[model samples]
Target: MERTERFCRIEMLIRSRGCVSFADLMTELGVSRATLKRDLDHLRTRMDAAIVYDRDRNGYRFAVTGRQARRPGPPEASGVWFSEREIHALLTMHQLLDGLGVGSSMGRHLQPVLERLQGMLGTSDSEARELVRRLRVVPPARKPVRGRSFERLAGAVLERRRLRLTIEADDGSGERDRIISPLRMIHDGGIWLLDAWCHESEALCRIPVPQVRAVQTLELRAREVPMRVIEAELDAMPALRAA
Candidate 1:
């Protein structure tokens, strides 16, 4: 198994058992003693695991307030810690993805990554939901969008694919079809926009999500854009542009 998978298993084992012996971890994970020790060290130092070895108990466990005095393990090492504000930010993002319509392909693409972050934060979806309730985000001045329209744009962006988008026009004008190589998906001022290379225009453009009436992802492979170009375009956006 991969290192990340091993890390998840280790966390589950220790959390479920309250304490776990190195020998037990080796047996369960089928990893050598050195690897197990390194994993434990990494978890405690990098991931904010409240863990310590207990000499008398001959195992590792989460540190408790009074238990530390009697257990007598090594001093907890200092490392990066997640602040409450950071957690709140993560939870807010969790809320955004969770609110997407069910069975969305883009949501599926993101689930694994989101799950790992949730595990690292030691938070559940229910907890995130409660947090979302407490801190509300009211979108301002955004036109309502059809659910399917949002899904198509998101799926295309996540998959790094081109899309055939039907752009609607005003003054009773008919819609026009354009094939775009999606570079990024962004939200601003309560509206969703896609930064893409338009085949019709032969230039980079930002398409408003609400104005997209229909979308279809092409089977053809997506054209790759350079990292420098994407970064330059992102920096040139109105929000990031220097006055």
Candidate 2:
């Protein structure tokens, strides 16, 4: 990757991970320690972002509230706002969920905002209801997992890093620390699966999120695994295929 791309990625990683160590950044970006350190210095000094070390965690993170402060704010209304088509699509999705009788916490939060958006567009409540009633989404049956861990796992995958997790089976007989390079998250058979590369097995694995006892991000970086190859491998897995 180019230096510029590396720098941009480092910045995004810091934002996503809340704080990253020189070693972690180097591993993730496939750059030298010196280069990663320089990038960190640039962010701290030039960008006026507070990046600090945590003794307990032995990692770098934002000084303010660590990872919590990195959460994105609400979208601003000005400049290249969502088009009418996009708004309609969003409403349609919400309606489909309503039809499925699946109440989402996110949807609950978005309801008021969606209503306000419709009002701004001068769309009547009956019309919005009708649109939602017409739209349908056949969501696969998947057991709900802890939302927070799912979010963290997503961050790890996007940053191309490894994760250390304790997985427990449904019968409550299995628990082990797994080092996985997460590729994507999928909901199937009413459970969320973290499609990943199991470092111990040196092969692809799909771990149920609900069965995950605890999650810890690893310092080891993820190798570039093609999505198509991962999908093909996943398709061949009897467990995944059945699910």
Q: Estimate each model's TM-score.
A: 0.50, 0.52
lDDT of 2: 0.66
Candidate 2 lDDT, tens digit per residue, 48-92? 446677788778765655454565742111112244666677777
Q: What's the lDDT for residue 224 in model 2?
A: 68
- Tens digits of per-residue lDDT for model 1 on 52-149? 88898898877776555566554333223344456567657656644432224356766765554554554567864565587554445665666677
Q: After superposition, how far is residue 29 of candidate 2 from its true place, in Å?
A: 49
Best by lDDT: 1
**Which residue pairs in candidate 1 collide?**
none
lDDT score of residue 138 within candidate 2? 66
